[model samples]
Target: LRILCNYAFNYLNIHKIYCKTDNQYAARLYEKVGFSHEGTLHEHAFHYGKYIDKFVYGLLSRDYLKK
Candidate 1:
């Protein structure tokens, strides 16, 4: 994932990236990839017959470049 992010930020020249994921597993992965939690939308998504919170994660190209 880190390699992929590097390629996207470098070769692709993307300045910012955003993602929405379930509250559980995505936290660690996002942190590992240097993405910060921007915010959460309460009950913004529905899955398995229930509403779930969606977390917003983002990373900036400049910040990734410094690593």
Candidate 2:
């Protein structure tokens, strides 16, 4: 994932990179790559007959460039 983010920021020349996950472990992993908790969509999805929360995470290209 870090490799992908690097390519997206460096080669693709994107302005921002984002990720959304319902799992806490995945969120922590994204945080390691400079993504931050941008927002959350409460109960936006359903799983196993129950509503699930969606977490949004993002990082800006300028921030990456500064690193």
Candidate 3:
């Protein structure tokens, strides 16, 4: 994740990275890696037999560089 983010920010000149997930573990990982909650999509996906809420996360290039 660190390598990817750095490559994109430094070489590719990407501004930010976005991630979406319904699991707390994944969300926490994103946060640990410098992303912050951007928003949520209510009932964004249908799982087994119910709808699942998805969260959007974002990490800005400046913020990523700071880490």
Model number with the top lDDT = 3
TM-score of 1: 0.91
Q: What is the lDDT of residue 40 in candidate 1?
A: 92
**C-alpha lDDT of residue 66 in model 3:** 86
Off by over 4 Å in 3: none
lDDT of 2 by residue, 1-67 (tens): 8788889989999999888899999999989878889999999999999999999999999987787
lDDT of 3 by residue, 1-67 (tens): 8789899999999998998899999999889888999999999999999999999999999999987
Backbone clashes in model 1, listed as residue pairs? none
What is the C-alpha local distance difference test score of each model? 0.89, 0.90, 0.93
Q: What does candidate 1's lDDT look like per residue over 6-66, in tens digits? A: 8899999999988988856778899887999999999998899999998999999998899
Candidate 2 residue-wise lDDT at 10: 92
Among the numbered candidates, top TM-score falls to 2
Where is the poorest 10-residue window by lDDT in model 3?
27-36
Per-candidate TM vs. native?
0.91, 0.93, 0.92
- Per-residue lDDT of 23 in model 2: 98
Candidate 3 residue-wise lDDT at 39: 99
